[model samples]
Target: PPRFTAQNHGNLKNEEEKEEEEDRRDILAHRGSLTVRRWYPVGTVLAGLYSVPPLNEVVAPPPGMATRLCFSVEYRHSCEQLMVSLLRLGNLPPRFHGNIMLVELRLLPDDRRPRQAKARRTGPDPEFCDCFVFQVSGVCVPQSTLSVCVLSVEQDGKRHAVGRVLFPLEGELGQAGRVLWRDLETEDDTQVPCSELGDVQISLMYSPCLQRLSVVVLRARGLQLLTDAGVCVQVSLRIHTQVVKIKRSFVAKCENDPYFDHRMTFKLHSQHLDEACLRFELQQPNNVHSGERPPALLGVLVLGPFMYARGPQLQHWMDMVNTPQEPVELWHGLGRAT
Candidate 1:
């Protein structure tokens, strides 16, 4: 029995419409003039398709910073000091078992002395809820950083570093009160040269008026291999065969998270913009270059325009183009040199 009701007629109509749309698309494809319809802008559509993070969103648990530490920082105006509260730690390694874990807090560069929390029984997860105060009476707190280190003490009273994280005093945490979770880098993460390349945080800005590009290398983790070595980030600008400029960050050694906080600028003309590309190489001492081979690079990252870059790299570059003169910060995972 053939039923011709309103619902049946509507279903048939939808099928016919879909078939017509497909036929139209096929015809357009054959003509090489196909343009897919989208509700959002091209950049938005591509970002969604690639699962890339929005430009404003902060990436959590950075590529190499697997271990995380939770804590809060507050500045006391009256006391003229900073108070750091130790909250809790997540993802404590299995090696911490049967040992006592402790959290240490201190200001970096100027203050080498560390204020440590009371050691607690080792467990998968532990909470300290401890408080430590650092007197910044005459010191410029804005220029300093708060370094957090998690250590495990053996029965023999030998202490070993479990993980470490560096929290800058400036930025969002500079205010009176703020709580944040930061990645704690471990030795094992960067000990061996494996498939997992480390991660680097950088900010890029391009000014059309000045015809210049600025790159700021903020911090990096999980770059060490074999042992703790002095690592410096080398930034180079190249357009095909011609090299525009080369710069390097000051070497940071023997730390979980090395903070470079260096900015390099290059004069980029409008005509060569499309072919220009920036290359980042994490270079280590001794392994600078193995004879005729290239530098023993810990990791490498590339950023360029649309034709040369893809995924998040391309998006980062496009964002700079779309909003000139504004800095765009992103966390890029380093990949082994091919």
Candidate 2:
């Protein structure tokens, strides 16, 4: 069932307001000047059995100073599906005085049969076949600490707990917090291979009061896949805000190979944004289009930008291409210039 809440809606509004202010500043600073460049890498793997670290980390803001956090995740593997949830916990200094601001969940590969394992072979049915990558971005709230948790679940209802790194308001640079993988539990009766699942989980904790940020990466392995079968990858993003109370979600899917069909979806909270404009393109080797024809274009529906306080506002953009109607040619720009 789809999860929706009032608190989530409020957060979305706060983020929208913050984003609008930033956009206004940018536009005023560079009037009549719009620089649209490809910031995310192409041919990026979105789904895989392995785990990759977030693109960047947040720095601790000075005590009482507001800060922003930014990160991303990529997956490149032939797994049945992938699900990611981002959680934010607040108030852990002396007394738990803060609120749980955000809980975002992303469901990737909108269409696909529930994955089922094939009959086991002889010794050790190859383990660790699902791979994925993720990136997270957000701003630090004043007078609050941030904690992030990434959980990866596989087919057959097997749940694997990655790692949980903590960011404290006051702590040594390297002594923030560590995730104890050995302490995590697995649902399958079979003993989970420690090496494969060791570093699959990644977490980032930040404290505005102390102005400190800590990042940790966890990995794990299970359910090997035959290389002969081509792989499909999916990616999704969910945003949750407390100030304005909004929950926004974006989903995309694509095949690892360029010759297959892929689909993408964008979902947003209704009360947050006015409208979302999305441009899709295909970049080929030697600056060519994917096929003989032009690429298709689409737009995302957003209620408008939600308002927020001092920190950076949350804005939505499609950094990656989940599916292309035709093979993308080597050229980058918004929707084929009409």
Candidate 3:
């Protein structure tokens, strides 16, 4: 061992830090599937937070309120874009002070379940930085882009579009330690076309006489090629905390715009119709052994008591409501899950 002054001790510490960082990088060399890669932070977040109600005032939350949110993304592997992620949002708004926000991270082009961080703030902006520090094991490649979305969580637990940010990895990191900040933009700032994610079509008919709700999956469009080409469906019914799930067969890999000859029917009781819900999910099943890879979510439709009164769900709801005598067909744009 060589002895030295205070400068040598400082140099030793820096060398240790560098060695640790190299160890972490070696561990992260393989990611998409293996669970061996541990979760770690990217760095400090540089973000600009906002609110439509003018966040400078004091606001208190009402009693007995809770937030329910799911940030969903129908995964897409390629489109001449990047694949990256921000640090995990610790929680929605991190603290409650009458602030409303929804935090969502979209990375898996193959997962049906949306990953999210949801919470409510009861006052003005926090006394410190309200940064959403996201983390991931594998997505730090060149030209890869990560999306950070902030939506509004309503009292009824539905998420509405609010604002979003895109982090482009290339040329973003000038030095190894410097983090940057940017502004978040809402739909009002710019209109984003829905056709980017593509669409799915279905037909529905409810027969009071037969006491059944019938659904026919027509087709899906604009899905990522080859990898996510083969798809399947899952239909579910929930009544009084009890759930019934049915998994359908997968379409052929050759069918990009898949059409199913499949028709799903559910028995409905008049008394439960007021409180029942029907859910149809488009999923890309895992091809290898179970747990070898996570499945991606293509799209999903939830039909509930008040669903038809809403936008896309309503488009089909009213069509059948007007002509209960026949089945109604409609196409809907696929949206991000969260």
Clashes of each: 0, 78, 28
Top candidate by TM-score? 1
- After superposing candidate 3 on the true structure, give the runs of residues whose Cα lies further than 4 Å from its correct spot: 1-195, 225-229, 291-294, 307-309
Model 3 lDDT per residue over 69-154, tens place:
22211122243323232222222233433455546544322121224555434333322223332243234433344455555556
Each model's lDDT comes to: 0.71, 0.25, 0.51
| Weakest lDDT window of 10 consecutive positions for candidate 1 | 54-63
Worst window of 10 by summed lDDT in candidate 2: 311-320
Candidate 3 accuracy as TM-score: 0.39
TM-score of every candidate relative to the true structure? 0.41, 0.15, 0.39
Tens digits of per-residue lDDT, candidate 1, 177-260, equal 555778776645544433366788778889998999999999887665544667788999999757788998888774656888
Full ranking by lDDT: 1, 3, 2
lDDT of 2 by residue, 95-194 (tens): 1122111212222112111122221111111111222222222221112222322222334443322222222222221221221111111223223433
Give the local distance difference test score of model 1: 0.71
Candidates sorted by TM-score, descending order?
1, 3, 2
Q: At residue 201, give the lDDT of candidate 3.
A: 69
